[model samples]
Target chain A: MEATTEARVPQKLTSKGRATRARILEHAAELIYTKGVHATNNEQLRRAAGVSGSQLNHYFPTKESLVLAVIEWQAERVLAFHRSERFAHFESLDSLREWAGFYIAYEHSYREGCTLGSLASEIIKTDLDVRADLANAFEQWKDLFRDGLERMQRLGRISAEADPARLAHLLLSAFQGGMLLAQVARDITPLEDALRAAIDHVQTFAVLPAADAPEDR
Target chain B: MEATTEARVPQKLTSKGRATRARILEHAAELIYTKGVHATNNEQLRRAAGVSGSQLNHYFPTKESLVLAVIEWQAERVLAFHRSERFAHFESLDSLREWAGFYIAYEHSYREGCTLGSLASEIIKTDLDVRADLANAFEQWKDLFRDGLERMQRLGRISAEADPARLAHLLLSAFQGGMLLAQVARDITPLEDALRAAIDHVQTFAVLPAADAPEDR
Candidate 1:
């Protein structure tokens, strides 16, 4: 996570300074999400955050730095949720289904699109440093799914024939793509269809019932 | 297709007029694909297309109109390829597999993200008119897959229980998402994994061997 955030604030920051920095980032993220990275300039962000120019500069030296920090901020928030108590382990297909359901049911998912996904669409055109940071965030996020799938494979819920890493990538891609379509349509049907298809694909490698497993019999 | 292109050129057009209009669209699409809708202005398009400002204006009265025209242009090009003799009918899982293989094997899929998809990411953020045009393009694209799946279902290759429309949307979502991930990673692995998962999911609805089809036996 530290490596992901090369745009870190000063180590000796006071509590008030930390609050101010966080405030700037919160507004910047909101602006970037609703508008876009390029459409959002320093002036609009300054007014939106209610911060002076120098203060904003003090926190984020350049526009690129500010963008990077926002990416880092969003990555932290999204990754934290995934790493939370309930979503941390995807032990079964049902668990993954629940996670997918969260995206469909969540208000922000409907209103805003996937937070990270929306940013990815805009930021992929930015410089290499920003893209690398965004890519790293995506890798870390994908790893969560991979870790869960690996657990399922080890438990024999998913067959060893299935590759967890590939499945994880599949799930994430479906999710990002689903979220984008849903956003475009302003309807959740696309997202629902995509997750169902992805989960169904994973189920293809599900071990057969006891009737087929003579050892169980 | 005309309905999709409410941004149509004038009813009366000399052949030269039509060619000049097309030149503007071709250059605009290229610039928009490489740069973006917001970043690629009329001036840049004028220079790229080797046309005068009034000429660019003659075809596209407004920037919004130009964007719609590009979306329509891209839609026609992409849909044409899908509707080509070889790809028009996805009669079997093998046909779909070959189509997916085409994406992976295609240089453009690796070099530039999806043609329509890149426009989609940016245009989705614009006004409803632009978004509507983009959405229509997507829906038309989705129908190509749906039509193929319907053919498969009618031929009894895919089971009757599967909804062709939903599966079509699923395939489109996977492709969109897979392409975006590949663009970010600059590798084709994510797209491959996503398409594979989607195709495997479609395979689940495949009718089993004659042992399960007693009538055939």
Candidate 2:
């Protein structure tokens, strides 16, 4: 839906106004998640968020702006959840495996796939304004993995030849692809296989020193 | 759109009618590729295919039916293209590398992401009927790679321990993920890195003879 010419985001809000804005965003996010961005209209948002037309307009001057905010929120939620569980501190190969296991389990339990990923998929072709936000979210997620791999390299757990940034992008790609396949097939096998293959590839770069090799008889 | 109660797919058609049906599907596929399924409506299809309302209804009683036919068409088109280029003959690691290189080049050339993949991502969450067709299409795509790997294993190019089915799934997942990221970023780097990593992982299972090992001084 197109915004009116007069539509504008409010310059500032009081504490109560901020609470209402958060409530509206939370509701809008759920609506957008359940119903796709194109399908979910402003009227639906107004009803779901229980905000007046003017109130909704004050926060999000356009539907695109609202969708962008939702993307950011979803990214923050995913990153915070992962960070809370030590997902960013991949000290060794074992930690990476543990993270993969947990990721698979989470996907199985929560069948809705990645929120940001689903949004990105739906709007990537049509919405130019949202692309930057979606790309930024993906980059942030990749950065977590890169930081962990870099730390592992510094500790000599990973070999020097492994490019942390490239490898991180590869892992993230496998993850997004695996989750999508798993969702569509209604099976976790694809996700498991993809993640395992990616992690095993990472293991190939483990710096096993000569001291760790067994002595010949 | 929901099918009308009176809507029904004609049980039989003449050769001329079949030709028109094929034309309709081709046009619809192109429209869906450009505008997405949800955005492309019956009116657009009628105009694009130059078919009367009765003719369109006679062929596809519902939009869902048209989408299903498009999915099948895309699957066949993709498989046929791959078959023409020896996609199902991974006789050696070099073949796999060649396939990956060709895949990256094709993605770069065609700015639009994978046709079936974009469709799957759009409809997977909401539509149940389309999900089965999408899943079948993906399986057929994966099968090409699986068959190739299986042939390699039988020919002793790959180790017995390497599971062709699993490895094929991994490669397919990576490809899907890479294509998506590349499409969003408008850069070929993600696709290149993901594909290279996947091919390298496949290489790890190569059955190397002892004679091929470099000799110590």
Candidate 3:
């Protein structure tokens, strides 16, 4: 009886409550994207989320907390997909081509600048914790790329010659740099070209069976 | 005798108490770069520039104004230098190579991030005037790149069939993305690789004057 009631009651949220929270985040992300973080406030959040003031505060006790939640949400949904099936078992040129295709499509949807990126740039002075979190996200992303590169190397798809760590670093850099430029320019040329070059370069050095160490002069 | 006063007097800045205002901007740029703009305040600005609080106000009525000054200064220096010199004549691979060399070496000194970028990120909810200026800078940069690409097409360095405007847009995106990643990750490997790849791509197309489109089937 207790289990039944508890399941129906929700550990803390009803289906309705979950939906409401999702709605709040959706609007909040939009506001944060358009307005500066400082300019966004709880009152605006309440109105935009269509919730009462008390509920808004209930879900998010503070603006910083709310922003942090949003950052985490984006990190999970937008950035973490790579760690899943998408980038998992990355070893072949086909996998890379598929990744590139997905990337191009995912990138086109990024009409607004990245919420985490926006916050990272804006909140550096106002909040050290937020800055650290954003910085940490990048580090993790680099790690993922490094892992992917290593997998590729082991599968005989990448050059054991070039350092996996270095390749990963380059790939991540080009990806982020291309996105930044695309955000401000409101064009995809920078993104497409940069990615095209990066993918082609990666393909060029795809591991050959006869790969050997550099010869001594 | 008159030279003594001329030397002692602060060099005439442009109106808006122009020269003194630029001094404020110069100091502000250095501060914003290292400290991150959010942490740097008006009093800090006054102290850093060796200007009295009143003098600081005399030049920049508010923090935002000082920020605007810095934006204008940085845009003019960084973008203009590239846009007018190597970038200005960017019709050939040779010019692209020279510019890339200068940019990467200069970027090594950047510990904080691009001043303009740091400001834009921080100014999320800043005054519309500031946003407008930031937007203008982005527009000017794209335009400059576009102009360079167009000249290349006209000179027959790049394929006449190539889209100069599109190429320029892509270059800007790649460049900015490189900078953003550098700031977040605190490394230059990605920037170095992206720039190198871009230069190589340009050279492959333009340096040889082979009279053929490299990417065409």
Candidate 4:
């Protein structure tokens, strides 16, 4: 069976096939977000993606590999969302409040709330590698907020002694807690109230040293 | 397999046997806190507790029930810890800072930290009953903090306009956030830094209103 080199060689896929693979990953993320990675399997993923059975098998030989792909996709999405200068654009706590309103509303309504957080929670029962991946993603997120807070402090928009890393951790935990409560209640009220109150505390209590902070970044 | 007249029913025997059960639960909590709930099992729990396999089974029946018992134990302990006057000693933010320090240090070193919270995070990935139990525990905790905050507000120690329940949510989330960060690092540094900043913010910025405002109780 291994005598012929050309027969054993893998063939490169067409553009459509590559697009189909990305579509499967996107759909897989949705399933993983809602149903959890362990609960979502190949058959469900195939049906959800509208791909044939053979196609899914062709791309990901195992569900774990597909889940890892979804995890990576979610990592990229969250990392990008945080780094899009949204945190930097805030003029003050008031502006942050406004941004928080938008954030809570959109997050609760769409985007599976938080795929990576859900993955982290889910994998605590199942996979070690996936848990590590999720943890790494969380660390990366904390770094983004830490960097933003440092810049704010240097510009006199925040106190020199302010701990950006801590605030970043606080922010991420608020979202996780809200998601947890929201999932339990099957209502958005907990998430909304939690977000509103959390942001208010951060705004009222976050240390801003300079009286004359710049409005434009 | 015939029963002896009245006593196939088993004797309510020695205090030593009862003591063994308590010891097992304590060690289960320890393992769950350090290695996580999913990673801890009956054989391991028995070995760590210095109890026999039969004794472990006599006490806990199943792994799920054992974890649930650990949770119930934690619920009682945490609630008792936060009882009014006990926790109310933390009246101002400065006191809150000291409290935060002691709290995190105790948490990291407290012979397996928080059993209920650890079990809850792991259980979120699984059964409905487990999720319901965790949700109930979280709500109960939030209520405990709310009551404490409300009492402080009633004593004119905090802002009358303060949302006691909301602040409770914020504080709990912040606590969880610190724990999670520390969990990943397998160290208490994140918990220390986060709680320090959070308590500092509360002290300096969360001032009370004039006595004329209505009590929120």
Candidate 1 segments whose C-alpha is farther than 4 A from its true place = A208-217, B2-7, B208-217
What digit string (tens of lDDT, one per residue) describes model 2 on residues B28-134?
Answer: 99988776777788898999899999989988988888888887787778767766656546667888788778878884422667787877787776643888767
Proportion of native contacts in model 4? 0.27
lDDT of 3 by residue, B110-156 (tens): 35566566666565355536655566676777677667777777777
Listed per model, the TM-scores of chain A against the true chain A are 0.90, 0.85, 0.76, 0.78
Give the CA lDDT, 0 to 100, for residue A52 in model 4. Answer: 93
Q: Which is superior by TM-score, 3 or 4?
A: 4
- Of the candidates numbered 1 and 4, which has the greater TM-score value? 1
In order of appearance, the predictions have TM-scores of: 0.93, 0.88, 0.67, 0.72
Model 1 chain A lDDT-worst window of ten: A1-10
Estimate every model's Cα lDDT from 0 to 1.
0.82, 0.77, 0.63, 0.63
Tens digit of per-residue lDDT, candidate 4, span A143-179? 7656766766666666665567777666666666566
Best by DockQ: 1
Isolated chain B TM-score per model: 0.90, 0.86, 0.79, 0.75
User: RMSD in angstroms, all models?
Assistant: 2.6, 5.1, 8.8, 8.6
- Residue B173 error for model 1, in Å? 1.0
Q: Which ten residues in a row have the lowest lDDT in candidate 1 chain B?
A: B2-11
- Which DockQ values do the candidates obtain, in the order shown? 0.64, 0.60, 0.29, 0.25
Instruction: Please list the residue runs of candidate 2 whose C-alpha ends up more than 4 Å from where it truly belongs after superposition.
Output: A1-11, A107-110, A209-211, A215-217, B1-11, B107-110, B209-217
Considering chain A alone, report the TM-score of candidate 1 relative to the true chain A.
Answer: 0.90
Pairs of residues at least 3 apart in sequence or in different chains that clash in candidate 1: none
* Residue-level lDDT for B9 in candidate 4: 19
